[model samples]
Target: MKLIKYCLILALFSPLAARAQQPAAPAAQAPIVLRPGDMQVQARSAANRPDRAPVYPGGEQALGLFFLEHIKYPEAARVKQLSGMVVVTATVNVDGSVSNPQVTQSLSPECDAEARRVVSLLTGWQPAMRRSRPLAVLIQLPVPFGTAGHMTVDQARRQPQR
Candidate 1:
């Protein structure tokens, strides 16, 4: 009976002991394969010109002023002293209209909603241009909400990333 017990204990622990004694296998390295034309540079064409980004109707200052006028501080944020920038991402359509505004960085629910509302209300955006053709683009607008004072676009831009 004692021999049987010892055999059972050995059987249970022998595999673990063997695994612990073995060194870890080295990682296999993948071979680098290169095909023809991999390093060849293509000639630049007029159609390959860099895309022009979308512009606001009144530019940055005017857009900032519009936000100052329209964005109302949320009572919840004010009560909680929640002061931070909410990053709102949206698509500027080929027609220069804003669409699909969403909160990418949220400070609070109330502040997020307010930021989305102000962004959606924006208009007169100049669509991006590629080779003189209008193109839609994604844009990130930072909206700041604070209880201390009204936040400006410059101030919002200066906020440290969380």
Candidate 2:
């Protein structure tokens, strides 16, 4: 018993054991150094690339205005005082048409349906281009319901739920 006790004491107090108990120091990371032209290889001339993202007919502001003008706040959501963004996903075909619009994130059943309706009505979308060739791409749009920015207080009050 004494021998076992002595072995245990020795093992617990050993220098190697004490070192193992301590947290290890983190290794130093070398700073990344880039030469003046290190990034030039990855960049291509804009004229040659011609890669572009899809654009709405009028632009971002116009798109937002379109939504604000068209979105009908659901009566169910208005009664509940619900305010949130419903993400609607759709594909922009090569011919500038929207297809397969679906609600990716749901705020409410009524709000989701309303969002889909608005998104379905969208038109005149310039399709994305890669190497100067038009490409079909999926796009997600956030439809706001009963939100302060989207549905103005006056608008909500004036157009009470029917």
Candidate 3:
């Protein structure tokens, strides 16, 4: 009986002794912080090299037409003499909806607001594709605001932008 007790005690303590003999895991390191530009660069690369880029329901020409019809060179932007393009970075969701629209380049507050509004209004975009499945992709769009941009959507639709 004495031998059995000692053997059992040794068996139980053997594992503990082994564990104590091993070194402890190294202390966990702090997580790396991602800069704002890092995400933009990564997103741009992914969007540009996608298996298939997101498309408007009708295609590239349709996208051009869509912007033409929906974008209304804001009156405030016009009055403020705001020209040039407002570049908006957006995520075309897997369900063909836009989310996370952000002004990457500022033309003016009015122009930026107008650009966001137009992006918000857009729906049913064909989502990006990879391996025959839909994906979310970051895309940058330029909305022009000026007399130089004036044109009827119908006319523009007839002659799609290249």
Q: Could you say which candidate leads in TM-score?
A: 2
Ranked by lDDT, the better of candidates 1 and 3 is 1
User: Tens digit of lDDT per residue, candidate 1, span 2-70?
Assistant: 999999999999999999999988878787566786743336635633267899988987887888899
* Candidate 2 C-alpha lDDT tens digits along 32-139: 777887844336555433267789998988988888999999898999999888999998888998989999999999999999999989989998887779988888
**TM-score of every model versus the real structure:** 0.61, 0.62, 0.58
Clashing pairs in 1: none
Query: What's the TM for model 2?
Result: 0.62
The TM-score between candidate 3 and the true structure equals 0.58
Clashing pairs in 3: none
- Compose the digit string of candidate 3's lDDT tens values, residues 51-75: 7789888876776677778887778
Model 2 lDDT at residue 119: 93
lDDT of each: 0.83, 0.83, 0.81
Off by over 4 Å in 2: 1-50, 148-162
